[model samples]
Target: MYIRDVTKVDIETVARISVEGWRHAYRGIIDDAVLDGRSVGEAARQWQEWLEDLVRRGDRLAVADDAGQVVGFASYGANRDQDNGFDAELYAIYVDPDRLGRGIGTALVRDMGRWLEAHGYEDVVVWCLKANPWCRFYGRSGARPVAQRIIEIGSRKLEEIGYGWHTMATLREE
Candidate 1:
């Protein structure tokens, strides 16, 4: 497996994996219609726009590849949290359903943290659904839940938890 910066060529693959990962990971948690009607093409277009902006700004967008295929991807930048404490935020992290449990997610996050640290960020934060067990992975990776909120998407109100890692030292040690 190889991890590197995302390119325009990876947009479609990342979008597909993002859609599939959402469908599999949020099956019972979110509205079924949302996942069922997810448009990979729209996602790809959105990724293209995002990539263009990232390239212009020189921001970090990382992808994991196996056998030349993108299996996972993550995007990070300055903290978007309104409270504005952490230096960085993990905007998104999605792994192909077939690649789950293979440490791809972990590697993506660890690398995101490393990138943040290298770029002068003192802390990194990520938001996840409170009901998702993936929080365990974050906990094990040295991030602790620091905040919570209920966010409404469509007609559903979902619990969102924010996790923060103050430094990359713990991820590095792992």
Candidate 2:
């Protein structure tokens, strides 16, 4: 598999990944009704706007392509909310539910770190629902718990944990 920048043709595929990833990974951690209500069309629309915005900001949106199939994707940019010493933020990352545990996420994250560092960003931050098992992935990627907050999703209040890397080198490490 290889990672590449997202293109307009990838919108539907990555949209599916985003919706499915949320439904599978956030099942117990988020409201059931919220997950069930997600539709690829809506996700694609949001992704369209987000993609345009990322380009406007000179940020990035990338996908993991496996034999022409998109299995995962990630986005990052100048930190929207500067905290600690981090100057960049990983906005989102989702592996196709069927592709989990195959190191796609690791590759995406490593690429993100490389891209950020090459752009002169020193550190990065990412946030996940506090109850998300995916936090384990962040921990494995050399991120430590650095911040926390409460966010409301579909009328439900959820706690989120922010993970941080003090140095981009941590992510570039093998």
Identify the candidate with maximal TM-score.
2
Q: How close is every model to the real structure, measured as TM-score?
A: 0.94, 0.97
Q: 1-174 in candidate 1: lDDT tens per residue?
A: 978998778889999998898888888898988888889999899889988887787678899988899999999888877594787888888889887889998898878877878888888888999988777888988988888889987579999999988777866766
lDDT of 2 by residue, 1-87 (tens): 999999999999989999999998989878888999989999999999999999999999999999999999999999998555679
lDDT of each: 0.85, 0.93
Worst 10 residues of 1 by lDDT: 78-87
Residue 31 error, candidate 2, Å? 1.4
Give residue 116's error in model 2 in angstroms. 0.4
TM-score for predicted model 1 compared with the true structure: 0.94
